[model samples]
Target chain A: MADFEIRDLRASVEGKEILKGVTLAINKGEVHAVMGPNGSGKSTLSHTLMGHPGYTVDGGEVIFKGQNVLTLEPDERARLGMFLALQYPVVVPGISMTNFLRTALNAKRGYDGKDKTKQVSPKEFRSLLKGELEVLHMDDSFLPRYINDGFSGGEKKRAEILQMAILKPEIAILDETDSGLDIDSIKFVADAVNRMRGPELGVLIITHYTRVLQFIKPDFVHVLVDGKFVLSGGPEVADRLEKTGYSEWAEADEPAVLKPEEVA
Target chain B: MATVPKVDVGTDYKEKYGFFVPEDYVFKAKRGLNPDIVNEISWMKKEPEWMTKMRLRSLEIFRKKPMPTWGADLSVIDFENIFYYLKASNKQSTSWEDLPPDIKKTYDRLGVPEAERKFLAGVSAQYESEVVYHSLQKELTAKGVIFTDTDSALRDHPDLFKEYFGTVIPPADNKFSALNTAVWSGGSFIYVPKGVRVEIPLQAYFRINAENMGQFERTLIICDEGSFVHYIEGCTAPIYTTDSLHSAVVEIIVKKDARCRYTTIQNWSTNVFNLVTKRAMAYADATMEWVDGNLGSQITMKYPSVYLMEPGAKGDVLSVAFAGKGQHQDAGGKMIHVAPNTTSTITSKSISKAGGRTSYRVHIKMYPDAKNSKSFVKCDALLLDDESRSDTYPYNDVDAENVTLGHEATVSKVSDEQLFYLMSRGITRSEAETMIVNGFIEPFTKELPLEYAVELNRLIQLEMEGSVG
Candidate 1:
């Protein structure tokens, strides 16, 4: 399929099934909102889609553009236009944000078969870093600081946006990017995401609340309950569920999300 | 006692024709340590009374003090069977062009002259017990910087050498220091004038060309007020069958607002006992950093230390040790903060493979008067397989209650998941292993110069090839 599609995808962690076979597809330029309550496999779906080592894909396929994402490494998937703004971004010490960004950017460039030249000089790198930081309203010194070290909630979310801006991935999966933000911070994050939205970009925003949708309104809404997509509808579904709650979806016994080939 | 090889190689040396020195290349002391040998060594290099007296006093201490029991066992060192001094050539050359063909070939293979021409502002090449080639930049000498060998420093500037010689670390400091004090040979003597900073680093290259030989190098560095300088030293020995002893003592003094960085990358062959004592004193607002790398050698017991003696002083030690089969690298750092507001940081990383052993033993102390002081020690060990061993024994004696001290340590083998990830990306298993190993030592490698870091990475990759399947 040319669209970003997850066909009956199921996954597990530590021998316990967490993501029951859930399926959804989004065309280019479509902004999809994955809304669900706690223990509803929302975060697990994002991680499984990115092929996180902790989450094993037991079945089904995560076909992005055309390739099976389940067959790619997380970094490889990242290079091929898939991104996960982790709910809890892992902190890798001694590796600066600027350094990590440069490496990731180069990896993507290699995947895209772009200019295979010497590294950008320090001056150019710093200039680009300054430009990106100014866009995010971040201080210049933040680039040299270890990735996500001592970052406030809002700063970390903004950092995630900055990464997305610099990387320019084809598909951006934001996991609870506005979970811990105040109204002003959430609006700022939503505005940043909206700025990144374009005809060629497919945004998959995963969240339990519809607060962020108030700014960057989604075109499609998918209800992921018990690890399977029990229901799918338009953006109004987010507003309807925000008021009615997930009680109706919780009553149904959905089939496992994983395909047989994914399970060992 | 094992005999020194007739046709020698340092340490693990073997004898094909019994013990005998090459006639063409002159100067060989009697195969023993005594007053006669000490006097012969000093007199052979030419006269300097203070140094001769210092050597005799060190010899006495070496005789009186028993072998050390705390660190890597040094009972294997046979004092009587070892030659305290061995010279490959007759005279010292201030330029590489003046060196003999045979000696020049050795330095050429080691890339000393090329390194000197490219990066270093000065060079000292010690072949056996004597300095064969020593030179300093004319501009560095014009600024009243004194850069020469230890014996020359004693001859040229006796008072300056005597003032700080035994003050920081005395011969009685340890058994090896005492031995080095007794028969100490060629090492660097560096002095930076007040307010002067040497942009390019000065380097010393030591080579041991004889077997059953003990190369005791004594170094002294003095940085005057507001001055800054960095010094680097490296050592290598040919592979042989008999054990050689390398005991070096390095003393550094950083005055008010001065900074000094001392780096050492040692890769001796398997048959060597490397026991070195390196210490530095940082005065008010001064900084001292030690970047040490240890690879190869039979058993190495080196703990470079820094003493922050005045307020606002800082000390840092970044060290990495690699131990392969038949190697025991016992290396770490010691930080003693005696003044208020002083700070120190110690980071030690080590790798062990093929049944090798690595021990990171560090001692940090904050004296009672050292209020508001802070010290952090981070030690990490990487074992390639189950057979290899790593140990972290950190002793913290913090008497100052107001001081902030943090100590963390971790030991882990390579992860299979990470390997699989790399392998699935079209990287071979060996390349994946190398990448993981490089990443593990990334913290240390990032601190080195570009070329040295690349060389070290390649060396580690080579060492890891047969270590794992």
Candidate 2:
């Protein structure tokens, strides 16, 4: 059964509707790719799922383990095992990446309030980060740098992957993480994500191109056009859409379904 | 709805610093300032004749000088209801009275051990490890460094005390200085001889100097030619004051080729009016740096200044101000370049929250004779909530065409994007803000001495705890 379900989730940015009637159901161990062009609401879906303050929920709900996750704070959603690798990660000038990650790892483990159980010791943190750093091919030098400050486009993408690898979220959304990266960097990011692929994790990779899909290999590929998924199929749909742009499916208002005939 | 918590800064202030011991003490003056009170304060200290006369003259100046209408709102201060001088014999430290449990709890959180917390509270006259302090004092004395209280200096080393007492900042410089001079009682007096360097910061000795706590404390330090010293005073704990007025005068003379750094981190009660006059003069090739951090008081109007008096002299001032609710920190620094080849840098960092307000006001000048001089100033303020406010008033007068001066000011609120990014990583909203605040003041905190930086970080934690509830 699908552990994470998006039931006709609708959202808005600055009073204008963005994600209208978007739906998805993905359980752990399965990797799903959300392919869309610019302004197709891929970012809106990811940000709304992670509870970005800029976006407001117009209707519907996001549910994980019998809880309407949209009503929860972004941090609460995160503590309940949700992650979004932002396209443009914020640049916080003085907070080092290592320090931020340690605080984040501790928070996920319920460290701050009363029950300080499973708190990540500094010793354990260094070793845990060392493994993910090796997977992302980043040196210890990256640890001291302020989060996303002065990082190159590819460096930012890899840093997001590093966070995903460290936090090891249950269901992850990669929002345009592959937009600016070159082929080699995209391949490395895919390799890192593939390594984290286990029965404990599910992923939603949102991008404008299928270059990332070629490396990450999604079990399901959905075409998001005009805020909702206008078409759904297997890997073949991505190839066809790559050849033909999103203009064909951009006018659809309701979500398209993957029929049993297509599945057969 | 998670029940939006009201953002309040320094909410633990009362619980931490507001408890008072019975104000009954021997040799205490009545609440108010007058000519007789000044004379009584001077006679109580047994000061020299010259110092006594100066105190009388300063009292007249304090009466005549009009209260300047500038910076923060000083109208709330009830001068008539303030104790001019109080020489309380050690109640918590010496007598049978025990230390307050809450203050003791704060000391424990600050990691101050059993024998030292009372001394830090300024109620203890002696430290249990007197020999340890004595050995350090012996080294300083051997190096010809005289570290004592101002009253003792006025009585014992009258000649040296008279030489530099008000030379840097005269009583007429400001009304607060005049008031401090009139009733000034206990503050550190240090004299470093030529070419000697007191490697260790003199804070250990300062904590033991129980007389450092007067409503009007006068401090004087002189670093002789080619000498060096770093003198730090005050701690993170809230000082107990029967009166709400705290006007201190700190004067220093950095002689030729000498360098001196004076560090002060004061946490007075929120009810206090902290008006301070601090100034220093650096002679030829000398360097003077004022590292100041103020975390308390209802209204604090202080601008630690430095005058570059000769060629190649430099002045550096780094100030940190945290203004919580019902507080206004109108603080900055002054760099007066008077000679050739002099340079100075003034950096101000302030954080305000919960309807608190902070203003960074700086006055910098380069004289016509100050050719080839340069000064750079930067002011940054962070507002934690929408109700908080911050302002920058910069006065840069560059007279010499050859001199270079630059000023930069930035007022920023903790951005929602920055907070969201951190919170999305599973850290709570309050914790995320705390991280951002600690980051915003990283430049200032990094400059603090190691122990001070540690204590400052812990203080940040306490402030955060108060911020959430």
Candidate 3:
């Protein structure tokens, strides 16, 4: 069975339909890349899957570990091992990153039936955070600073990946994590994600460009257009789209289930 | 749509801390305030003639002065119906076991005795209109440091007490001050001799257990040259349908090169009016800090002030106010720079929820001689729901051209995005809000002692429960 599955997912924002009849599935250890042009509902799908309050799920079935996720709160969905690395992480002034991450990690552990009332000890949390910071090549000073309050764009993205590393979600969705990063920073983030990938973890990278995929290769690449996946193939699909651009798929009137050769 | 989980927010702090045991008092004054009632109080205390005359003069002022038509609504306050004085115990004791069982039980339930044993250098517990219990560490007393109730201080250290009592906040300063002066009873009085530093904090706990009680406790602290002291005071009242009144006047004098920190955490019941007058004078090279947290009371109007009297003097006021259902917290700070090179900073944080209202009314004044002085005032108000309201009223009067004065005020609602972000991190909406609110007031709480800071956060979390959907 799939670790996470979205069947005929339809959603809207403020009465305007965004994710219309979207369907996808990801099992543990698999990496699925959904590439699309701007305003093609790339972020809508990620937000809808994570149950952002702004997006209304008009009709959908988001199943995580054989349970309907749409019926749960965002925090509930998060405890069920679903994580969304927001494209633009929000800044919470005076809330240290260490405090937030520890609270989140403890919440996840609590939901996993490991003594919900017990929190991670300070020494344990410190060592865990230090290890993850080293993995992401982040400075230790970032731990005490307010969560993303004055972080640079690259720093914010890297922090999101660090959170993923700490939480170790079963299904991780990265939404435009590579949008605002230098080449070196992109490689750092990609390397961190690649290191965390294993049979117990499923990855979904949503992006408008294929540059990030070069470092963190995906098992399947899907072309999303007009709120639906028009094509699906192996990693070659991303390479072909990189050469051909998304204009052809975006300009099509109807959803086209094209093969990798057809796109080429 | 996912239904928001319902968590029980009911914690009966009132039942635990508000239960009053019936005890026969030594004396109880009439419900009305007049010259006769004032004289009776002074005569009951057996105060000096000069103190009695001061009480008479303050009574005249209190009677002649009209209620100010600004800030909180005072029409609901019925001064005539308030009991001017109530003495729960005849004499103050220096030991917890010596105190009356009822009074001792009250403070024990409030955790006053535990706090004293754990951290405090001394403690003065006031019940109704007088201090029922008082104690201090022998080492502090041996170092020429005096920590006792104000009433006892007047008798024990009359010379020093007479020189500084009511000096910073005089009776004529305001109507409430005048009223407090006319009927003031029990409060903390501290004197740190020159070059002495009281490393541990001296604490005082005030409780009003009677209905329609008017508690007017006058506190006076004097930090001599090169001395240092930190004093903390906390208050709570039993729940009652009829309103009670707490009008206190606290005055402090920080001498040259001395430092003084005064902290107050007042958590009155909803049927209480808390109007207090607190002021400090910081002399040359001296520092005076006021760390205030106002959490309860139906209506509160307090703005602790400081006056920088000489060069190199500094004043800092950090305050936090949490106004829950049917409460109005009109609290802020005031700073006055009277000499050159003086500095002051005021930070106010307020939260309103469940149709409550909070307002920040702060004033900053720089005199002509206060050249090169700098003052920064920041006020932030957070409203938890649409029904809650907040307001900021800042008055900055800078007469000196060379002074740097900055004021910033922000009124914000807990943003949906911030809440959603925290909720997405596996925290419930209510828990996330509690965290944000705690962080918002971290600047003020961080200044508090560890125990007080932890208690403040717990109180705020209790107030924030069920506040978000």
Candidate 4:
């Protein structure tokens, strides 16, 4: 069985269908890239998979580690080794990043049936946070600031990657993580992800552009259009799409077929 | 990752601190207020004749002044049903063992003595109508610092007490001030000598442990030239079916080049009406700060004020109010700039939940001669539900030309995106809400002492539980 699977998932926002019978599966040690155009329901799928309250799962199931996660709350799904890196992170003023990260880490640990009676000591937490920050190339100053309150665009994205590094979920969903980031930042974030990659982690990189794929190569690339995956291939498919553009798949009514030569 | 204990957020908070001892008073005055009751209180205290006359004059003012019709509902406050004077103990002692057992137990439960021994430079514990226990560290006393109850200050340092008492805030300043002056009994009086700095804070605990009690405590502090002091006070009352009243008048004087900081955390049970008048006067190059937090009370109407009287004087007021079910917190600050080049800042934060209401009432006055002065006021209110309400009423009277004044107010409801962001990171919904609320008041809580800040955060978290379905 796949480590995580979304079977015929249908979701809606504000009574309008966004994810229409989307099926996807991810294994334990593979990176799956979901490339789509604007308004192609990429974020909706990410949000629905994580059980965001605003996104209603009208139909289908999100099975994570053999448990249906659609019925769970966002936080519950997160503890089940599912993580969604938000496209537009919200700013929580007055809460330091260190405090929030620690709380989140502890919550995940407790949910994993660890010894809930013992919290990570301050010294241990600080050292761990320091290591994560170094991996993400974030300054120690970010730890004391209110969570993303006045952070720059690149800083917010880096902070999200930093959180992902600290939490180390089994299946990570990076929703447009490369958006609004400069080339250097994209490289930095991709390097951090590459370092954390191993058999224990599966990555789902959602993006509108193929620019990020130049840094973080994917094992499989799926073309998502109108809430459905129309074509599936490998790294060469992204190179082809980069030249052909999403307009071909975006405007097509039926699912497009991937020519054999485009697959790698 | 300790198993988060199931905090009893639904339980009555007053129950923990509200367990009352049997009524054993050395003197108990009759319910209701009149000139005779005021004079009788003065007579019982054996106060100087002038003080007795002042009490009579204040009683007249209290009667003449009408109930405030603008703020929280005052119709529920039945003046005729309140016991204005009930002295639980006769003399104030320096030792906890010397205090009456019942009163001592009340303080022990409230952790007054423990706090004093831990960090406070001095402590004064007031029960009902009088200070039951008072103590000052010998080091502070030997430094010419006077920290005692107001009643004792009047008898021991009469000349100094008479010089500054009622000078910053007079009897007729407001109706509650007049009422407090007429019936005031136990409160702190601190005098810091010139150039002397009190390193640690002097704390006072006021606990009302009786039904139908009216606690009118008058506090005054004087920080002489180049001196510094910080005074903290905490108040709590027992749960009663009928309403209790807490009307206090606090006055402070910050002399030339001196600084004083006063902090108050009032959690007076849901059956109490807490109306207070607190003001301070800052002289040339002096600084005055008022950190006020109001967490409980059926209705609370308090607006701590500061008067920037001389050049280079500064005033800062950081206040936070949390109004839960059936509570109305009408609290804010006032800053008056009377001299040139003075500066003032007022930051107010409030939260209203469970059909409760919170209002920020601010007033900033810049006099004609107050040129080149600056004043900044910020008020932020958070509503937890649609039924909860928040309001901001600001009155800015600027008569000076070269002054720079700015006022900003915001009323916000918890945003769905913010909640989702926190929850997406594995924090529970209620925990996320509590974190957001704490972050909203971070500026105010950060200004508080470490222990108080932790307690304030805990109280806010307890209040946030079950706030969302």
Best model number under TM-score = 2
lDDT by residue for model 2 over B153-214, one digit each (tens)?
A: 87889899989999998989989999888888888899999999889888734445555766
For model 3, residues B1-55, the per-residue Cα lDDT tens digits are: 1112122223542255342233342554468888777876776666777788888
Greater-TM-score candidate between 2 and 4:
2
Question: Which runs in model 2 stand beyond 4 Å of their true positions?
Answer: A113-117, A250-264, B1-25, B90-131, B204-206, B467-469
Q: Sort every candidate by DockQ, greatest first.
A: 4, 2, 3, 1
Pick the DockQ winner: 4
Best by lDDT: 2
Q: What TM-score quantifies how close candidate 4 is to the native fold?
A: 0.87
Span of ten consecutive residues with least summed lDDT in model 2 chain A: A255-264
Candidate 2 docking band: medium
Compose the digit string of candidate 3's lDDT tens values, residues A18-47: 888988989999999999887889999999
Clashing residue pairs in candidate 2 are: none
TM-score of 2: 0.90
Q: What is the TM-score of chain A alone in each candidate?
A: 0.88, 0.92, 0.92, 0.92
Better of 2 and 4 by lDDT: 2
Task: Give lDDT tens digits, candidate 1, residues B1-469.
Answer: 1211122333332254233334353665468787877876776666557667877888888889988777677788888988777663321213445433433343334444454421121122223323432234566788888877777787788889888887888989988899888888768889999999988777664322221123787889999999999887773322222327889899999999999999888876567899999999999999999999998788999999999999999999999998888789999999999999999999999999889999998999889989999999999998988899999889999898799999999998877655544332233456556666777777887877776786676666666765311
DockQ comparisons of all candidates to the true complex: 0.11, 0.65, 0.64, 0.75
Query: Model 2 over residues A26-64: C-alpha lDDT tens digits?
Result: 989988988877788988998889998999999998889
Q: Model 2, residue B263: displacement in angstroms? A: 1.7
